[model samples]
Target: MKKQLHLLRQLVQQAVTHSDNTTSIVTDSFAVNQAGDLLMIKDVMIDYLQNLSFSKKPEVFIKRKILHTQRECITLLDMLPRTKMATPDQVALADQMRKCLDELLRHLHQHNCYFSCEVNAPYIEIQRITDKTFQKMTVMKAALKRKKIYSELLNIICAAFDRFHLSQQHTYQHLQYMSALQLSILKLCEKASDLDFDYQLIEHLTYWCFNECHFVDYCKSLIKKALKPHYGTKQCYEQLCHFEKRLTVQQEKANLRYSVQRNSVKYQLMVFVQAELECIEKKQQYHSGGKGVTLKHTAQIGSYRVQTSFSVAALAYFMKLLCESGIIQAEPRSQLLAFIAHHFQTPRIGEQELSASSLATKYKQVTPRTAHAMKAKLKELCQRIDDDFGSGD
Candidate 1:
């Protein structure tokens, strides 16, 4: 009987949508559709409609019902502070049920399950004759996107983990707890990335925890038991703590990496700056007899000697800074400077009409030389780098 009745509602809806000029005679049809399954289908359709509506209003009654049911389950399991009545299985089952119910409630709240309002417009838009039509420019409206309550989310996740901790009392509950904590941390990072939160401490915390685990006490102890032998020895694992870093590593590592990168770029600038000076020297030699390579001087020799001189000088200075000072090791700094010099040490541009500033600007960086009057700017920069960072040597 219910199925037959359901068909009547669908049939009536189809007729109404197709109705055209039969407004009067079709009145009886509309009346039949309205009365057919009003009790059964009205709320069902409204429930589906709620999914499409986005509102900020909270549904207190529905939330209360879910909370009430969840609390009842928890109570039945005796998961209270004073009660040891809950068995391991009961605690786990109750916690899972509560989490599921709470998730549904959150979904409903996000959809703004119940809200209605009325607005009355008093004026009919009037079109005027013999008048100008004004065009309004486009405008932008700012809106706050719904933000996750991370603290609340974290608490719920911890609650679930507490149940996990209670249920098994396994050695690896510590490991699982760490997993839960890590997931919470990742969610925090995601929220910050999405502009829903502004947390600036993650980077600093990452450095503080560079070689340490975030979890301690019971959780860490549990994990220590779990990872006793089957995997990576506790020393090699370098987990990142930042919720916002585009690069990985402790904060100090990131800072040093940035410094090294800047220096490499500066060195490249120095290389090209030297090349410009060389071309100038060549032009002067061409104007005089010394500029052109004579029968005695080969172009290859001129190129190799000048390039090797600059390369050795730059590399030696860079290595000296790293080795002699406590700043860095000689090997790493030498390798880095060599890599940069290898990429940038191209033949000098012949005396084209382009000025040094224009060439540097075209490359999107300011040169230390043309932007200044110093004839030995490259040498000065290398010397400064050494003086500032150089140690005993």
Candidate 2:
């Protein structure tokens, strides 16, 4: 029973890692299917162990080892705190671990009922035929075996704890780096007011900021995966306490606000570029003595207006409509609208191109009637914008 339990636990660990890998990418669905299959297999193993018999003397020793292992598992459950943000798959794995522990304990209790009074008198006499010294030595050997079994179990659980701890640290560092890059780009956006700012630098920063957000999302995924199991260990718990102390709830909220500020940074940089172009166009018009020049279309996103001549105004207006329609309920609705508009309406280089289908996969979906209403609203807005601007020609 001890060996079977250890082997089963190892299988579960591997399957969990596999599932995490499968769901990491947005382009694939096969991995998700395979992951589901793997989880089902783990469930079968749990059921098998729950029903396995453990009534004889040697089997009783195995039962004691299982009980000790279950205790250790219970300690691990604290790793997955209710407050932590975990992915759905990670939460399911935690639930599976808890259920397995409970099932083992329940089966052990059932086994106890059979030996409540030891009513087999002939069996008791047969057990006494052995010499007292022999019986003592056999019991001591069983105790040693049980100790060895528990030692192996501890190694497995502790190793898992350490592995996830390192994974969390790595992903956390990546998150910090992404946040820093975002801050630097926003600083550049602010410095554009000086009139001598580097357009090239802003362009590069804009591209980097847009591209690296995907990796930021990937890092978040890794963090959620490791958050639960790593916190089970004393070392990890201490580390988390220190880290959380360093970043209080107020500080986190401040950071989130700062992040939202950075959302407009790219558009603000583009506005600077448009201003430069418009200045050149005005100078050329003055030089040419008042014939005419068709100004390039530029799009605006901030405030409650479309302050540009481009088709991006239509996109921005549609996004406002989407937000007011209650499609996305995130705080700072302006920022959420900007994110959805940027990704859905104007994807930058290296960003995932999202369509309605892909958006449905990630965010909330409306019912058929609401969907039809939203579609009609979008169509009407698009027609009005097109009739007003005539494609910016």
Candidate 3:
């Protein structure tokens, strides 16, 4: 963890120096490169802190290290030269770095180590079940029929739901455990489906299940309700703050316990799922202008009329393919559909024009199997064209 932090510090130094060297008239590429550097540093620091929180070190030792690391990050950030005339992009980048540092400090100051032996016992038991279920998933992946695999996965998920219900205390650690189990179930589903399923879709479904079952939100509401009586009192404020600290500590301890089995398949699956989710979040932020950077959208071709006949489903599927392949980057599904509707003659049912909502619904319903088949067909066609045309050359 220290090594990772050291690497993060170096990245900060490099980024700061690069920004300091910027000319008065900054080129677009230079600004982008600088933003990328800061973003990389932020990601590295976050991963480092997560790893530290999950280490098997003593609580006192971990807390001390966190404080020190937080200070170091703040000091490095202070070195970033600030100017009154700084561009909005530069200001946004600096604000992002500062926000990351603030979160790190909050993690250090919060405490969450209030679990008694009786309370802790349930978590241990759940951990055991998680490990056992994960092992069963690994062993049965190749041998079990898809139906059996689905049954086993559903059983484990149901068991998690049951355990969550039986618990008297709805601590944050319990929610974390439930979340980890959900990710494991998603992995099992992906494996059973021979990786033909849309991971994002499965992730959305799993989270939706949690919401529909009222598991996560209920637990959070319970905690908040316990603190509700103290709303305006100073004593209440202090008590609530203390509780938050303890919650943070307890959550880290839970992470540490899970990290003991970090080499397990389930653990790797959790990591992969988290990384993919983060990637999706970053992409959304980039497209939505959350990074405080202004991007020019320029068209390479002049407007032209297009006469095409295709069902909404076909058009939606093609748009999805293009976005997933990086050929297009229209986000929010609606934006992409709107672009297509504007430029092409879209098919419509008798009275209604092709609606963005309808197209988005079809987009979600498009199966991965169909997408892959279409992609393969396109590749084969391209190969044939290349082969036939190469003879003339």
Best by lDDT: 3
Which tens-of-lDDT digit does each residue in 108-161 have in candidate 2? Answer: 445443222111112112222223323343443343344332343224323432
Candidate 2 stretches with Cα past 4 Å from truth are 1-60, 82-86, 107-393
**Span of 10 residues, lowest total lDDT, candidate 2:** 116-125
Report lDDT (CA) for all predictions.
0.33, 0.40, 0.49
Q: How much lDDT does candidate 3 score? A: 0.49
lDDT-better candidate, 2 vs 3 = 3
Clash pairs (backbone) in predicted model 2: none
What is the lDDT for 336 in model 3? 57
lDDT of 1 by residue, 134-207 (tens): 11101100111223333433343344434433432222122322343344444445454322131222332222
Better of 1 and 2 by lDDT: 2
Model 2, CA-based lDDT: 0.40
Q: Please, what is the TM-score per model?
A: 0.20, 0.20, 0.25
Preferred candidate (TM-score higher): 1 or 3: 3
User: Tens-digit lDDT track for model 3 on 83-173?
Assistant: 2224676565555555555555345435323222122222323444455545565443434345343443344445555565465443334
The number of clashing residue pairs in each candidate reads: 2, 0, 8
